[model samples]
Target chain A: MIKVQQPEPYDPLSQVPLVPPPGHYSASKLERVLRKGLFAVTAELNPPDSADPRDVLKAAEPLVEVADAINATDASGANCHMSSMAICSLLSRAGQGSVFQISCRDRNRIAIQGDVLGVAALGVGNVLCLSGDGVGVGDQPGAKAVFDFDAISLLRTLKTMRNEGVFLSGRKLTTPPNIFLGAAANPCIQPLEWRAERLAKKVTAGADFIQTNYIFDVDVFEKFMETLRKEGLHKKVFILAGVGPLASAKAARWMRTNVPGIHIPDRVVDRLEKADNPGEEGKKLCIELVRQMRQIEGVAGVHIMAYRREHMVNEIIEASGVLADRQ
Target chain B: MYAVRLFCTRHARAFESVYKGLEKVFLSLHPLLKGIGYNRLERPVAMIEQMSKGFLFDCKMCGQCVLSSAGMSCPMNCPKNIRNGPCGGVRDGGFCEVRPEMRCVWVEAWNGAKTMQNGLERIRVVQPPVNRELKGSSSWLRIIREKGAMKEASKRQLDPAKSELAQAFAKARKLEPAAVPLAKEPVAALAEQAVKEQTSVHSTQETTSQ
Candidate 1:
């Protein structure tokens, strides 16, 4: 029989806690992970277009201390980019927390299994499993997809390795990984009901945490939470809302109107239109959105997706009252 | 010739008596043999049997019954026995592990069901867990026989004429030839020789083409 332990009530409006739920991992161990995050924050770091790690490492320097972990994009939307694994290794060597974003596309089950073991061996524990963007949208349009497993299957595979010490093939691991498994969610894409249902599936598949798509509306997010509560999955996993600071109003509008899955509410667009400088206005809007997300009941954290504005992550976190030291 | 004639005369009378008795039994079993509905001899029985097997029943795995939900037949035939889901091993168009022409029965079923109006809603009902004790064991057969007996007991009150088609098919199978007599060795020898000649001629033509 599994023992259930109750966690201490957390205030998301204050300093965000990085602790795993009670009975999931030991409370002491969760405390250790949280202690590591006393001043740490995470920034999504996309890899450079060229093969060299010099430029990538240079780009990641300011984010190293301000952000706890530097998330490396595996293949952001199928475009040709430097390998995430190599960049992660470089970032880790440079004393940055390397959170590797591993996608299911372009890899078969065998390769995926191998990469998981390989990443664990390399001491990169944080992994985000995604059913990546289609090859048609990537730089290599002619390339074929090898969706040997979906995101849920990959999550299940990882959980099996960690908990049962067994691979998907039922082979025993020599040493089981203590990896923190994460997954992605698009709450803004489909009907609120379907989105909730899909999110429930992801949780059931054993996602330790979730990183959502860009947040443009807090009401839609709250509605999503309502549905999640109805489905009885509110307490199961940690949710990190994705927020990106727009470089300009044009970029914000493009993301809202042109992007397939992102929905930017009209109120946000109206606020951006009235501001003196759109970039500054967009940043302020992002900071406000982050502040609002922090007030949410079950949100564990916020994943700031600053697009090309990676440096502003620290400022936004500080302005939102998530980082107390700055205030 | 004289011996053959004597033997035929001696057995003819006995053979006629046996044939007459069998014909009487067959004619008594099915009155429908004389009518227009005669072609449906075994079809109705087969359909009833299939339905009794619970082939169209919803799967027990809930939250996402992708198979019954999708419209594909179950993947219980696959060794892994994945329900409401397909394994990573499925290839293009979601074919099964063993056969290519036969699409992943579950995927095909789901696709077919999804296109139909109100079809997806039918899958929302709960399916009971598979009674594992009734699978791959002798007890299953015993239970089936017991149930069949109970059915027979209840069915006895119905008119015998109502089940005439099933009775006729059973009688007809018994009357049909069980096995054809083997022709003499000369025919087998001729067929084997013909196959060898054809292979040799094909090989020669291929060599010439090369």
Candidate 2:
């Protein structure tokens, strides 16, 4: 890992660390918002391919006002980019809360365990554990795939570090990390009946929240939430539905065919195809989904992944009016 | 191998009972195995394990066998090697995201588990990461040795004498197993070779199935 020194001296007034409220896991704004029973929104930051700090700030410019916390992806889609840890640190320095995403595709247990402490010390508030894409899916297929820990074990390791104050090997730590833990879910995938059970396993392994894959079929997602509600898992962990703009009918079809685990419904594509401006129609669809999802019994919030349509996020959020009542 | 693997999963209930019976046999053979020397028996035991498990499940010999817990499916065959539940990348038809032609191992495991008695309970256990050190070693030998030692210790505890046999057993428990080098190649190299061999074998099976 490349060590980038903190560029400037600390300005305490810019971002004062909040003390965790009673029974709160971390001092994350997102956690506080969720616990308050208010809808929370998290947006993914487009990781810059270069070392410039301005690129990070520029990408975060639109999302800083609307999102409760920004997510820094770790080489999502198995493609190389600036590391999530560095982006988190930069975001933290800029007084914005960031979720540092860690994938088990590249790093072993030793590296991940050490990173838990590193991100915590940097004032990052949340860690999202993911079983990342395979190396074969990436540009660099020759790279060794080191899945030393799957998402469940990764969640377990972090839980051990935070709650037990020890490493996976049982070595003691002076100060355990104080951060919220999250795991990803795909409610639209195969073996739909087992999806809720899998989430149960994740919650048992110490997930504080869950963010799911893109949801185009609300009926299927509703069924998934119904299962979770029946098991009473919704009360255990917060769930944020993944929603995103489709750019155009062509883009929606492309994603349906190429992206794994993402099931874009035929009606959605037909809706996009009928619109004169599919890009605007896509944003409208996202905003509509956000409004609809908030009315669901167990949905805590929406995770809007705009991808290249990042510029449209603020518009979508504002139009959705999900956060209208909040200051 | 693919057909056999699927067949085993479909009959996972019967295989579970068979596996339980074999475990008993292996435990009972511990005395003879110990006399012949476990260190010397590693090669022969590992060879037999590879031939049997390899043909059945295309096993990668991860050494820390969780086949029973995984619904008789070998998780090491997963492209990302996820041991818990299925990843978020299973294709629409329950195929693997990495290897599009192959079924997702966890999907098969879930189906297989549905056929077993205690399948749901067993599959829910969160498995720890693979101990890379245990790769290429014989999981059968490891399980047999561990269970046999445990049984002997319990028997000693039940004895009224509470004599030298108990004390000797207590002393032996703390000692590490003898360091027997099972592979001439580095473990990482061996792992890579195993993966390559699996891919080739799978390709051949794919062709034959077609």
TM-score against native, each model: 0.59, 0.86
lDDT measured at residue B54 in model 1 versus the true structure, 0 to 100: 33
Every candidate's lDDT = 0.54, 0.81
Off by over 4 Å in 1: A1-41, A325-327, B1-66, B71-210
Give the worst 10-residue stretch by lDDT in candidate 2 chain A.
A1-10
> Which portions of model 2 show Cα errors greater than 4 Å?
A1-19, B150-210
List, residue by residue over A43-93, the lDDT tens digit for candidate 1: 788678886779898778556545546678888767778877777667645
Candidate 1's docking class is incorrect
Candidate 2 retains true contacts at a fraction of 0.66
- Give me the overall lDDT of model 1: 0.54
> Candidate 2 residues A1-327, lDDT tens each?
111122232233565444567888787888888999988889998898999999999998878778888899999888899999999888878878889999999999999999988888787879999999888877788999999899997898788788878776666799788889999999988878688889998998889999998998999999999999998999999999999988999999888777667899899999999999999899999998999999999999989888988898888888898887675
Candidate 2: residue pairs that collide: none
Candidate with best DockQ:
2
